[model samples]
Target chain A: MHAILDADYLCHLGFIRDGAPVVLPTLYARVAERLYMHGSAGSRPLRCAGEDTGIAVCLTVTHVDGLVLARSAIHHAINYRSVVVHGVARQVTDPAERSTALNALINHIVPGRAADSRPANAKELAATAVVALDLNEVSAKVRTGDPNDDPEDLALPHWTGVLPVQRTYGTPVPAGDLDPSVTVPGYLTQR
Target chain B: MHAILDADYLCHLGFIRDGAPVVLPTLYARVAERLYMHGSAGSRPLRCAGEDTGIAVCLTVTHVDGLVLARSAIHHAINYRSVVVHGVARQVTDPAERSTALNALINHIVPGRAADSRPANAKELAATAVVALDLNEVSAKVRTGDPNDDPEDLALPHWTGVLPVQRTYGTPVPAGDLDPSVTVPGYLTQR
Candidate 1:
């Protein structure tokens, strides 16, 4: 399957130091064959639990597994996963370099989306901000599949099965101002 | 909308804390008009860092968005949204009310998934464990879109539109061992 680094799948990436969580809504990263963000401006939406806000940065992403329906209600469970990165996030300041970073940001959220959208203008660039965090300290953890049934419950007359869950996409709705001649991109058709 | 508490849905909930995440395969919970999980056997998933060992737990759920299609690209993004809770989960081990708490968990996840599924037996009940948190803090964030565009490019006249995302459950596959005589329940059919 072709890979997509979408905002919806990306959990918030976070960093915590000295008992605090540093939220970075947009910390560009690459893992295996994927990239992700917390969807929105992570840093912009961060609510710090500490007073000393110098230059803290963190990365976090989550995947949801609805629930595990077991024969015995108590044995029922959930399957899900997530990752978090803790470290220092320095703001990007170089003008030429920052512009390139913005493209990375756009592409990171929707690969090739940068080309579909306009490149940031000088003023827009100034308004936009980027943070670079070294992925030195990171963690990935996951829980997958059914509940651990007791050796005895195996014989119960109840029905036992897993309800597989999958996300689907629908037809696109064009922007109101879109030209009447505009046709929806096929790429968007599947989503 | 009816507030139904599904034990399955509550069991699906997990969180990250202390930088490491601990994900339980299953936990008891309730599903009502709104979802709620009482502090119990839950442990902080992010108790450590690095690999699976460092992650105490990770919470994830996928809400289906429709399907995505790109004439030129196969890269598809699920139009769904999810939230991850990471933190330290202390077992809710009060000797007295654990049973009621377990029922709460069932109702919270699926409103009636617990009642629909088999109930916990005696030995199973004694073995059942619940995780709880004294610091009940969580956040909900989301995103929705087709594609973003630059102001000037709007006049360029390239076909631009948003593919809406939706999730629809397929026919429920029943357990093979069950009696074919039992038809699917009303909730399962409409859902």
Candidate 2:
């Protein structure tokens, strides 16, 4: 579960809003047994979490590793690694905990980034809402290897294989206002 | 919205379960203004949608374009294209609609794939459940360009830029039982 959660920094957060289910993609970071996600202070999920009882949420992170093609359409599948957490997310009001969660979110994107970048100011922090969900009811599911085909269908004259899908990073395009002297950091290049 | 939905086959589906929101990653295909997804007949969401008036769901598809790094932690963001659909998904019982939905699901993964693979048998179709949601209440949100950093923070001696992220496909690995004579299909290689 830890490995799957740490592999990606983005997740889909689901919560009920006005008797309807709402799913939104947001940035997330994992710290030990807790998962933290932040958004604008005025966001619906954040506001609901701040109520008397925190909102019940189901946070999921999925990594599509490959496409499994089989001889039959019914047998086709996708190779993926996913982690799902079911819990009630509460607003992080403590100053120390909020600071740690914010730093973790930054570092989660690019390792060692929190130290290299400027920390959030008081005004900036005030405009953000951070929520925490404990990883107690977390489960990790994975699907790998070849496509599953029936023995009778093996000779059906159809191509059966796994199309490996991977996430690749291209050259970093520097900001227009960046100074020429500021070279690309080792953490960014080494990844 | 059509282009974004057609670019990816996997989606995070959210629906209310026991008064709590549950998000699960599943395969989806978009045909015109309707979205189709399928799973086992016994699945919770499928069973719920098969009930009286169907089930309210929020289906979302997100493509992470790049990582935006800013001088300040608060300004960091992700460049992405996302489509969210909020509606009631009902189970499809008509044989014709089910067949079309299944074909769309296969072709959505790889164009021209449905023709190459064998069609599902009667028993296979009986065990599967297909659901369709009209794209009536749909919204597409996108974020692009450079990171938004304050003018004062631009010269803070920190690296700021956009790290482009793309999905790449590797060579197809054939299944062990696949006949050696069945070469890789053009549809898979062309992509």
Best-matching candidate per DockQ: 2
Q: Residues A1-191, candidate 1: write the lDDT tens digits.
A: 11222334344444443443423233354534333222222334322321234245445554454345566776665555655555554555567655565565545544565566445556555544455555566666666655566666666655554454444554566656577876665445533
Show model 1 residue runs off by greater than 4 Å.
Answer: A1-9, A14-58, A94-100, A142-147, B1-100, B121-154, B158-161, B171-186
Name the lDDT value of residue B13 in candidate 2.
Answer: 97
lDDT of 2 by residue, B84-145 (tens): 99999999999999999999999999888899989999999999999999999999999999
Per-model clash counts, in order, read 109, 0
In the order shown, the candidates' DockQ scores are 0.27, 0.90
**After TM-score superposition, what is the CA distance of residue B49 in candidate 2 from its true location, in Å?**
1.3
